[model samples]
Target: MEMSSKLLEKAVSEMAHLPGIGRRTALRLVLHLLRQPQGQTESLADALLEFRTQIRQCKECHNISDAACCEICSSPKRDRSMVCVVEDIRDVMAIENTGHYRGLYHVLGGKISPMEGMGPHDLTIGSLVSKVKEGEIRELIFALSATMEGDTTNFYIYRQLEGLPVKLSTIARGIPVGDELEYADEVTLGRSIVQRIPFEGSLKG
Candidate 1:
């Protein structure tokens, strides 16, 4: 808990703020970095700084990218008509790892969690509605986590798209209830995507 150097203390403090990292782990990481060559540490700092400063959100799907549009959104090989709705970039990465889906994505940024003060306006739902309105998207696949918040967010979007011509579907419940898509194994996630069911059917019981 006590560091001999104030600089080391500061470094550990900042590192501990990262998700899943505790003060002990942060101190260990800081010590490891100190033991590394000076250039390597500098390179890491530079990379983090550049990533924080230069990363952009894809203009179409809100995925983190190096430019205005992400590679998936801009790729002609992707099926633009099939848009998979996910909670964030992590979910996109998870689905991409499965390699079962060739469709484009729309990152909702976050779910509607009242306890966390995350609502529809706090997310990219408006643009998603606009995309559906454009009629270019023929199918919308809900790939959100199986938690209550995820279902709430999905139902909200379903209501918004009522009467729209787009085919609505959700990933099959191959994933355990309340599990995050990002945490599911590639095979299960792939099967879920490949064997998706109609949204209306998922709502019944």
Candidate 2:
């Protein structure tokens, strides 16, 4: 069946490519955007373009930033001695939204999954090891998910950093297995921060 205008169809098609958006929702959103002022449309386009043109990865932590280094990495108030290791940029935002953490972060960019052709070499694992070894950091917290892939990645990093100067720890167990950090409630995430445990073999309790 023939649909609406080519422009409307185009917008919906593009939106449908996003993670959770479907054709029906995308069409509704396109219609909603169509009713907005032309300036609003222009602003959206500009913002989309600017996302890449303006933002870049932080050299130190590998997080997204408008500058070479993210504000978190440059902030003196942030605990340079503490570094939270996460799988992706989204996890960084999830943790930052809680406002319960005061340390810096190191985004691995992805988990270690041989099935998907992602391995330790593909992530920032080496950088993390080097960072912990420099003696500038003290704690390395694994805040990735509880899924199999998340566990694999965590184990990979933990083993490599076992002999480093920093303390290796994992978030508390209340998160429940198979849960993604992005979907975790802030209260649970905050509580986990307080009760994180030392990584296996880190030190005798």
**Most accurate candidate by lDDT:** 1
For model 1, the superposed segments whose C-alpha errors exceed 4 Å read 175-205
Q: For every model shown, what is its TM-score relative to the native structure?
A: 0.84, 0.80
Model 1 CA lDDT for position 159 = 99
Cα lDDT, model 2, residue 123: 96
Q: lDDT (CA) for every model shown?
A: 0.94, 0.87
Q: Which ten residues in a row have the lowest lDDT in candidate 2?
A: 196-205
Clashing pairs in 1: none
Q: Tens digit of lDDT per residue, candidate 2, span 1-205? A: 2476887778889989998999999988878888999899899989999996899999999999999999999998998889999988999999999888999999999998889999899999998888888899878899998779999998888888776667788876667667999999987788777877677733532
- lDDT score, candidate 2, position 135: 91
